[model samples]
Target: MCKHILNAQVSIRAPCCKQWYDCAECHGESQTHPLAKTAEMAFICKKCKKAFRKNMSEYEESDEYCPHCDNHYVIEAKTPQAIVGVEGEDARVDNRMLKDDRVKQSTNRSLFTINSDDLTDKVG
Candidate 1:
């Protein structure tokens, strides 16, 4: 349940602390020290819950996925954004913030329009 990367498919095992984190930002926030760089990075796949290692030097496009579950772990991180409107707000609270600008459909009908029988008789 990472707030930084909502769609993160794998947890990276920080080489320095040997702790799992969804992203570098998460590691930075939880730990006092900066994330350590390593040529061979370890990752735990969220889908299969398996651990695997990848050598950065020999990394390939196929290495982007988990070897156990074949789940694509490498993807563009989806970060939270600041919205100006009620687009991301909860539905219950949105009513208070949004104005009802939609035009109301008229329910009023003329006598002639309502009495279709009379209009049909006149046309016939």
Candidate 2:
């Protein structure tokens, strides 16, 4: 297994080209265009090539494995950190929802949703 696979840190899915790359540096080096906006990105398991929404909810299971590639991994749950949006020189977390208690609750739900078509692997 590659070191990234052993570490369980998945590769990034470039929204612009819809291809997987190791990291932002890799994308910047290999591609001519700029990186995709953070909100419009996903991650793929290095081993199995399984895709995960940015919230990473899909890989939360203790026995996480890619249904497509059957690559195994262990991902520990992490504390919720403020998600900041970076646009050129400006960086900020939209605070409009900060007043909502429900938004602060740690839950399995993701802030953004994925369309069924956005998912590459169909389990059925």
Candidate 3:
């Protein structure tokens, strides 16, 4: 009798698109998932079940909603970053917060965020 170990296989889902070209992902109109070059954006979506990078066009100026769950990230007004601190608290944290790289968003979270000035990947 041969001892068998069932190796678990993980399935990676490609961003929804028709084309499989490498560069095509960066193309806004090219039908590929674009990546964030600077200033990371991450969020967990209850609907999507996984975090995915999406442009600001997905939020539509609303900072609370997930781009993948809620399309139309761009809006007439700019969305203010969600303030974690409270008013009149001068929100201060210990030095440990800065040094802690371990504090990271989930790997399943999406990172894409749209910028008006950045139509395409600038790093490219």
Candidate 4:
């Protein structure tokens, strides 16, 4: 069981392998090296989907609202989205059989509801 769940609040790009992680703890547990203080950090606003550079002076004093869309960043596990598949196979596929799950890439889109009874806020 993971102590902290990787959610939509923020993500850190590991300096060791340049891979995105939910936090330093995630990086430390998943990676071999420790995260340095000088390493770059970026926060993604769940509402706007815009990345806020942590190193920036402007962002250092910011709060919960996104600077781009002013939408409150929802700090929770996002709903599972429908996975979409690529049209063609990989060129260097040496194996004859391709797994069904491997054929498609999972993508999470924005949380804007077009039409639903669950939607309470109306933006026009």
Candidate 5:
């Protein structure tokens, strides 16, 4: 439900107000005060809906996952971007997105094909 980080896997509990947010930019938009920094951080995994805490001082590579569900919560955030695109489903999955109202060539013809009747009539 976060607008800033579209692919956020976990909600971080802000040390400042103890409120959960998907990203620091989201916290900044709703809260008036700046985020507080702390060595201990709390997070709620979106997949398993479980809460866990990690001490930044003792943080390790293994701490990047939720202890209860083993869901990898640490990942590169996918933020929204400003771009122009056709307003339709993915063209790869749905061909309708790529459909255009234009004249199409016949599939049952070849340039080298010649009518034998036309040649015989001309000879006669």
Candidate 6:
């Protein structure tokens, strides 16, 4: 409580956001485009504390690689991972289909004349 109150009283400084620029081809030699490269990246690792680009840059351009394990890592921009939970429900339409002696067509109309296994039975 006391720490929160003290923090609130102190002026908090917001971090500066970086602006990115196009590649060297877009602003080469005589070109005077502002900031052809970004100041810093957004996503950073806690263990390494190094900034890493999240965009679809080449593996060589990435700075988030694990030095200890030499593992390449990329952070996705568009979609994050999703977690789904399955609920208990009756998923089977009819178990009798498997027990049927005659092979039925998938469309439920008529079986095709194609030479196939399991659909034809031999009578001894």
Q: lDDT per model, in order?
A: 0.86, 0.59, 0.38, 0.59, 0.87, 0.36
**Could you tell me the TM-score of candidate 4?**
0.42
Q: Which candidate, 5 or 6, has the higher lDDT?
A: 5
**Which residues of candidate 4, in runs, are more than 4 Å off?**
1-8, 56-60, 71-124
List clash counts for every candidate, in order. Answer: 0, 0, 17, 0, 0, 0
True-structure RMSD for candidate 5: 8.0
lDDT per residue for candidate 3 within 1-124, as digits (tens), equals: 1012122111122344332221222335444356324333333343465464535445434654454666332323332355786345322543433444587754542236555655553343
Per-residue CA lDDT of model 6 for 11-122, tens digit only, reads: 1111221322122222233244443333333443334544444332433554456443434443332323467965544448545434457976675333455445545543
What lDDT would candidate 4 get against the real structure?
0.59
Q: Give stretches of model 5 more than 4 Å off.
A: 88-124
lDDT of candidate 2 vs native?
0.59
Among these predictions, the greatest lDDT belongs to 5
**Residue 95 error for model 3, in Å?**
54
* lDDT digits (tens) for residues 86-115 of candidate 2: 445323455553444565644544436555
How many clashing residue pairs, candidate 1?
0
Error of 6 at 51 (Å): 7.2
TM-score of 6: 0.22
lDDT of 5 by residue, 104-123 (tens): 97565444556674453233
Q: What lDDT tens digits, residue by residue, belong to model 4 across residues 1-124?
A: 2246534555556656777777667788887878866534566665566777555334443455676887665446654466897556664674445545656643533357454753544465
Which of 1 and 6 is the better model by TM-score?
Answer: 1
Is candidate 1 or 3 superior in lDDT?
A: 1
Residue-wise C-alpha lDDT for candidate 1, range 1-124, written one tens digit per residue: 8999889999999999999998999999999999989999999999999999999999999999899989998889888897785355776866676678999976654554646544643432
Which runs of model 3 end up more than 4 angstroms from their true locations? Answer: 1-38, 54-64, 71-124
- Model 2 residue 82 CA deviation (Å) reads 34
TM-score leaderboard ranking: 5, 1, 4, 2, 6, 3
